[model samples]
Target: MVELDSRVETRDGVALVELVVRNPTDTARRFRVGNLLDGPLWPPRSRGVPEAGWDDGGFEGVVPAEERRALGYASPLSGGARSDSLPEPPAEIVWTERAGETEAGNDASFAAEATPEGVVRSLGDHRPPADAVPTPRSGDTVSTPESGRSEPDPRRSP
Candidate 1:
């Protein structure tokens, strides 16, 4: 399982509600993020985590072991809505193990060990600048390039 935390910032004009997931698993596996039941809807331009379910409403992706990943969606500001209402992402998250993957029974606990300010500052260093293009580390899909988007994996991305 991965521990998660939420943070929001206005990049340009979009209200980017970002979630940082801490993967403590030893092997690479995919994780799922439930929908924002209380906050604004996720926009199309919003990147980071992969969409899950047949309808692509939720998020699914691979997080490398002992690494931090920023996965989130963005929403354009609405006239009637206030950005203050944005919900802080939950600290608890679940990492779904595939059929062949080992299941580390949820015997351990996940906690937000770092300060919020420290986490925010660290995220800035992981991602690349807006104008940069990502280079592929795997065959087809392009992972997060210079940005702290995603950690590198020798195997295919889920």
Candidate 2:
């Protein structure tokens, strides 16, 4: 069986997420992990809002090819004989944020057992600087304060 774990953290307005895929089987197996974007949560409509799938943010690297073969998969990249595409398991997993938001979608599913044995980090912080202007490096552009003609105190800027 495959197991996938996802961890999310937010810092400075950015969200950091980490995904760990593990193969518990004695043999190796190939697998794919995709991020689900937007979908409805399980139980339907009671949650009052839709959820975001894995693709909504970021994803970890592809599962190793050798591992796929060990799992008896005809082709690691392909979902196998179950269908022209990979099979979709029941909606057994659900992730919710502290803000009462939920994420769900078809692509949200991943080989949990194929995930690595670590935490998943996602970064979502995008706050602008408090008062300082950004300067370009190695270019002929000069960085002046909002005054457009004078340089401001560097200490006051971020």
Candidate 3:
């Protein structure tokens, strides 16, 4: 089965409609949502061109099994006008079809199973090995190549 939730908001003389379509069944479904408002429907634009199916005052696509898809459109108000009344629900499910069915109760099997055998290490970690770290004895002076000078290692008391 399919379910739909719709909302509309007006901004700058344009009504923006958003719809969330949900497919609860184990089968994928294709659906068409038609514009229910009085104004013309304007699907979202790509590179200044309206999306496909904008002329038909509606949009259509597939919703995967057990998934929800969000769709949106815009309708420009006449003469940059504003209305005090909230627009009626801007979209309606005009039709729906079962695109395909999946194996029963197989939804959770696609996830890969993993077991952590040891501490994970990344190639970016350039730290030296534990035993390779230098530990200076108390009162020892360590020489640094950068300054060509010897300084007491701060880790141990002088």
Candidate 4:
């Protein structure tokens, strides 16, 4: 499971949020993290692969939170300029697995902050913090963590 924390702070003239993600699994998995409303949001890719579920217009990089925002990217939960029509920011962590896909079990909100190192420390993973968000997976559809969802057969194709 992925643990994410979202909180708000200010940058430039906009209110932004920071999302911290932690990979509890022992094996390093390719993942994508992003704001649902802003099309594709930021650390665009990890371990090389596209880290599923990310939309277009997403940038790729691994840096601290402060540097991400300084580059003018919206916070993961900012929702850009269409907040009224979009659902609350559905920031998530996603990865590809035989089960088709999997998403972090929670839908958390976030705001911007300056503590990039703190965010990285909070993530508890070795990956550098950056502005890129992740993609979503089919695992997101299952509401329970212990639901025992079956993994897709690797031999099969979508």
Candidate 5:
């Protein structure tokens, strides 16, 4: 079984989220995920971030060949562009599988929390610093591909 845990922290008004992906397999694998938090509590509507499935990297996340990677910084939650309903943490994740040694998409077990001030209330202006931008991998210029979702195991409790 795989484990998926999500942590949400509000710093300087920006919602910083970290998704931890763990694979129990002997070898490392790749996983794709998006809308990891797209559900009722975290409605598609946003006052902070672009729609989960929008231009924001498709399924918008990738768990690298490492056994465990915290995927954040790349996707930060924003207070809705027009409203105060800040975005909630993604509640789910789907890892990708290639043909050869690829592993099937395992359901990510999920968990979430917010700072006292970041508890799904109204938000303030908290854009990232212009210099905090992420660097591309070596010479890769394109964004990571959007991921397809698979049947998440029964543990969907948030």
Candidate 6:
């Protein structure tokens, strides 16, 4: 099951909203926290690409299994105006599913693999360390300061 708790506060001419979404089930759940109040939603951060939940008339993100995630947004009040009525059940659940169970699950190549580390690491992360010096490959001419000469790298078998 999913649980939602929301609080709204008006401060400095803006209405600040804080929401806590909880997932108490064994499966992870996806939810949408709608903007039931007046004005456009401004996520926690405004710069760069827009956050996950702001574009769809609300905030949308995943709450992991047996875990909760906090989401918040702010809306500017018009001339310090106030609303006498508030929306009931400020947030609603869109859907929930087992973690990593996607439509692509039917494909063997796209299946998700759980690791002992409890985190998925990308396959393209094999690049050398950021600070590591570039090594000359086979057939590349390298200049050596010790010998003061240019020659094929000794590290490679000719």
- Write down the lDDT that model 6 would get: 0.61
Q: Which sections of candidate 5 miss by over 4 Å? A: 36-55, 58-66, 74-91, 98-158
Considering every candidate listed, which one attains the maximal lDDT? 3
In order, the Cα lDDT scores of the candidates are 0.52, 0.31, 0.68, 0.39, 0.44, 0.61
lDDT of 1 at 10: 62
Error of 4 at 100 (Å): 18
The candidate 5 region of ten consecutive residues with least summed lDDT is 104-113
Number of colliding residue pairs in each model: 5, 42, 0, 21, 17, 2
List runs of model 2 lying over 4 Å from the truth: 37-158
lDDT of 5 by residue, 22-47 (tens): 76655545545555432212323344
Candidate 3 lDDT score relative to the true structure: 0.68
Ranking by lDDT: 3, 6, 1, 5, 4, 2
TM-score of 6: 0.54
Query: What are the per-model C-alpha RMSD values against the true structure?
Result: 16.5, 17.9, 16.9, 19.7, 20.4, 14.0
Off by over 4 Å in 3: 52-54, 79-87, 100-158
On TM-score, the candidate that comes out on top is: 3
Ranking by TM-score: 3, 6, 1, 5, 4, 2
Return the TM-score for each candidate structure: 0.44, 0.27, 0.56, 0.31, 0.37, 0.54
lDDT of 1: 0.52
Candidate 2 lDDT, tens digit per residue, 1-158? 54666554433333233445554554333344443322211211112321222222222222332132111101122122222222232111233112111211122222422232111212222445554555534324445756676444454433
Those runs of model 6 whose alpha carbons end farther than 4 Å from true positions after fitting are 83-90, 94-158
lDDT of 1 at 58: 52
TM-score of 2: 0.27
lDDT of 3 by residue, 1-158 (tens): 78999888888878888899999987888888888776777777543444433445787667888999888988777763565554566688899997745423212121321212111111123445556766676668878879889998665442
Which candidate would rank higher by TM-score, 2 or 3? Answer: 3
Error of 3 at 42 (Å): 1.3
